[model samples]
Target: MQFQILRDEEGTKADFLDLLENFKPALKEIRTATNQESINEFIVKQVPYTLSAGELESIWK
Candidate 1:
């Protein structure tokens, strides 16, 4: 299974991190700037993400 997660760094960083933490085990692959840059792993670490960009925008509002 593949998943593309869109996170609003300024607003939903917590939500994003929570998702990663909660689903880390089920997440077969993990890629980030630090991981990719330091290790050059994964074909493409970053993919265009816009599906859930605003899913949590109004959670606090």
Candidate 2:
């Protein structure tokens, strides 16, 4: 998932967080009123998740 330029310190592009929630709807169940922690953890986890893959591939492809 890609994060676009922030509209503000606490806001991002309209669909940023929605991407992950759409990928794994169960995430919404655990989501807090604010998405800060979820967003941080997702980005940090992406480093390892992407590196372990053989090649970069977009799910859309």
Candidate 3:
């Protein structure tokens, strides 16, 4: 996954460090749940999402 960080010039490092600290717990939770069967189950339980045939065709083209 990719992320873009937008911030003011002032105190960027402190802001980034704080963001990293806050994300640690979420990362740990994801790490603990890192298994293929669990991931497949999660995807199955999620509401199915789709695009129109026109949209898919546009992407393929």
Best by lDDT: 2
Give the least accurate 10-residue stretch of model 3, judged by summed lDDT. Answer: 1-10
The sequence of per-residue lDDT tens digits that candidate 3 reaches over residues 1-61 is: 1113422334343343444455555544654334534633442343133334443223212
**Against the hidden reference, what TM-scores do the models get?**
0.26, 0.25, 0.31
What lDDT tens digits, residue by residue, belong to model 2 across residues 1-61? 2443323334442344444455455544555635635544556454333221212112111
Clashes of 1: 0
At residue 60, give the lDDT of candidate 2: 13
- Number of clashing pairs, model 3? 0
TM-score of 1: 0.26
**Better candidate number, 2 or 3, judged by lDDT:** 2
The runs of at least 3 residues in candidate 1 whose Cα sits more than 4 Å from the true structure, single-residue gaps closed, are 1-11, 28-61
Off by over 4 Å in 3: 1-5, 8-11, 32-61
lDDT of 1 at 37: 42
Q: Against the true structure, what is every candidate's RMSD?
A: 11.0, 13.4, 13.8
lDDT of predicted model 3: 0.38
List, residue by residue over 1-61, the lDDT tens digit for candidate 1: 1224442333344444355455444432544546434422221244232323243222212
* TM-score of structure candidate 3: 0.31
Give the better candidate number (1 or 2) by TM-score. Answer: 1
